[model samples]
Target chain A: MKAKVTVRLKSGVLDPQGRAVQHAAESLGLQGIQEIRLGKVFDIELETTDETEIEKILETLATKILANPVMENYEWEIIQS
Target chain B: MKAKVTVRLKSGVLDPQGRAVQHAAESLGLQGIQEIRLGKVFDIELETTDETEIEKILETLATKILANPVMENYEWEIIQS
Candidate 1:
């Protein structure tokens, strides 16, 4: 199965990199951009086709190996099976 | 409109960070892992609701401001309008 996991900072979390990107974009003269929040995406390819196993593995990987529960929130979905 | 932009290294590009994560995950006793590719996500909020304008802005932002055309590919989608 193929899965995607996305991890992003919580709404109240500080995102300096995102701010920098926003500043840079604004400086580039692109108008109407109010905000830009950055995050991480993990595209995972696995051997298993079982949806249950994929979900369990993605959940564990997202929480334990990828995202920090305190400041970031994570979501994952199976794309191909 | 609210839009999302995802940028990832091209298929042939080297991704050291993703390799490190893969190694770390393997060492953590997690099985069935074949590959992990890392990417970046930008959640952007714009003031305009026009679809054509949003697309034009997003295309410019993704190519010129966010992604490196030599090594990375980017895709964007409108989430809300």
Candidate 2:
């Protein structure tokens, strides 16, 4: 089974990288770009096919290591392949 | 309009960050994780609603700024909200 985890900054959190990207967009003549937020994605290949176990493990991984509890939020999905 | 850009490392690239995360997962007692790859996601808000223009701009952004052509691959989608 394959799992994807997306970790993004929480609203109101300062994102300097996103701000820099926004400025770069403007400089590139792509105007009207209001906001840019940067995030991280993790693609994982699990050795097991048990749906319940996959879900449980992904949940733990997302919370424990993939995201900062105070500043970021994370979501995960199982991709059928 | 909103645009989502997903940038992923090309296959065969060495990802130390992913390896570290894999080790962390093992330490956390979550076994059976065969491989882990890390990537980036950019959530962008644009001031225009023109679909064609959005596509053009996003394509440029993805190639020139959002992704490293030699090591990463990128894909974008326009989101309707």
Candidate 3:
């Protein structure tokens, strides 16, 4: 199975990198870019073919290591490739 | 339109952060984690309702800012929410 996980700052959390990007965007003369939130993505390729198993693995990974539950949020999908 | 952008090291590109994460995973006794790659994701909220326009914007962002064309790869999806 192929999995892609994205971990991001929670809605109210502060993101310094995103802020830097936002500042850069402003400098580039781009307007209407009100906010920017940065996150991390992990792309994994595995041999498993079961969706349920992949989901379980992702759940454990997310809860244990992929995200800081208090300040971050994560979402993932099983890539079919 | 809302967009979620993910940028990562192209295959064969060296990633220090990914190496660090792999080391951390090994320290945690994770098995079968042969490799680890790290990427960035951006969750963007926009007031516009057009997907075509969002795609154009994302293309520009990916090429001009979100990724380093030489060694990085990027993909994005428009989020309905």
Winner by DockQ: 2
TM-score of each: 0.97, 0.98, 0.85
Q: Candidate 1: where is the Cα deviation over 4 Å?
A: none
Q: Which pairs, if any, clash in model 2?
A: none
TM-score of 2: 0.98
Worst lDDT run of 10 residues, candidate 1 chain A, spans A56-65
How many angstroms is residue A37 displaced in model 3 relative to the true structure, after the best TM-score fit?
Answer: 0.6
| lDDT of each residue in B1-81, candidate 2, tens digit only | 998999999997999999999999999999999999999999999989999999999998999899999999999999996
- Those runs of model 2 whose alpha carbons end farther than 4 Å from true positions after fitting are none
Worst 10 residues of 1 chain B by lDDT: B21-30
DockQ of 2: 0.92
Model 3: docking quality category: medium
lDDT scores in order? 0.93, 0.95, 0.79
Q: What would the TM-score be for candidate 3 when compared with the true structure? A: 0.85
**Displacement of the residue B6 alpha carbon in candidate 2, Å:** 0.2
* All DockQ scores: 0.92, 0.92, 0.55
lDDT of each residue in A1-81, candidate 2, tens digit only = 999999999999999999999899889988889999999999999999999999999999999999999999999999997
**1 or 3: which has the higher lDDT?**
1
On TM-score, the leading prediction is 2
